[model samples]
Target: MADVRKHMIFHGRVQGVGFRYTAKYLARSMNLTGWVKNEYDGTVVMEVQGREAMIFELMKGLNRNQFIQIDWIDTEEKETETESSFEVKY
Candidate 1:
């Protein structure tokens, strides 16, 4: 399958839970490229790019994390990037 990219806003208890690191690990493990960051409004924002299935897997990994309590995710499709690494944005 072709690669896809998503811009996601994760809501509900996402801050201060090592969410960025967790996302970075998962994304890198899956060879997904993009970035994750904490929002001042208590939400986590991420842009992930990879195969559609891998993206789905990334979501699953995050949802399965014990410390992260995700109430909902707001997402949109985005144009993919050429970056080769996933990162935790400061």
Candidate 2:
């Protein structure tokens, strides 16, 4: 499938854990591009763009981490980006 972008808000136990790092790793390894950051509300926000399957795999990878307990994820599709890297934004 073609590339797609998703803006996501991950809730519950996202901060104080290695959520950002894990997301960056997973995204990059899968050749996905975008950024992840911690929000002031103790939630994690991310925008990732890549193949649909890879995006799904990225979600599965995040959920597999023992420390990152994602109570829920709010996701929305967006216009794709040109960047070719995944990052953990500060």
Candidate 3:
């Protein structure tokens, strides 16, 4: 399958709630490569690159978090990058 990249911006109570850490962990477990960072506008932005199924699974994993309330997600399909690992960007 051709790898895909998704650029997502998650809104709601995402920051200061371990969202980035959880995303990083889930991405590593699923062997997805990308980076996640907290936006200045109280949102979280992430770019996940992997198979379609794995990327969806990562989203599901993120939604399962109790403290992180994802009110909305703005997603865009982008050209894939040669990222080797997922990281929590500061």
Candidate 4:
């Protein structure tokens, strides 16, 4: 599988809502390599690099939880950097 990297901006009622934790879990399960963080603008920012299928699965996981009110998910392709593993960044 080809490695793909994306910068994701999740909008809506996401902060303090276990979004980052869920994201980490999803990423780990999908064997993704990158990081997730809460932005000041109330958006959850994530960078994920992995197989396209796994990335799609991770996005699906992100969408399944009710605690997260995902109004929108903005994604953009990014240059893949060498990340050893996925993490929740503070």
Q: What is the C-alpha RMSD of each candidate to the true structure, in Å?
A: 0.6, 0.6, 0.6, 0.9
| lDDT string, candidate 4, 4-41, tens digits | 99998999999999999998988887789999999988
Candidate 1 clash pair list: none
| Model 2 Cα lDDT, one tens digit per residue, 1-90 | 799999999999999889999999989999999999999989999999999999999999999999889899999999997997999999
What TM-score goes with each of the models?
0.97, 0.97, 0.97, 0.94
Identify the candidate with maximal lDDT: 3
Which TM-score value belongs to model 3?
0.97
Candidate number that wins on TM-score, 1 or 4: 1
lDDT of 3: 0.94
lDDT of 3 by residue, 4-90 (tens): 999999999999999999999999999999999998999999999999999999989988999999999999999999878999998
The residue-by-residue lDDT of candidate 1 on 14-69, one tens digit each, is: 99888999999999999999999988899999999999999999989988989999
How high is the lDDT of residue 16 in model 3? 96
Off by over 4 Å in 4: none
Q: How accurate is candidate 4 locally (lDDT)?
A: 0.90
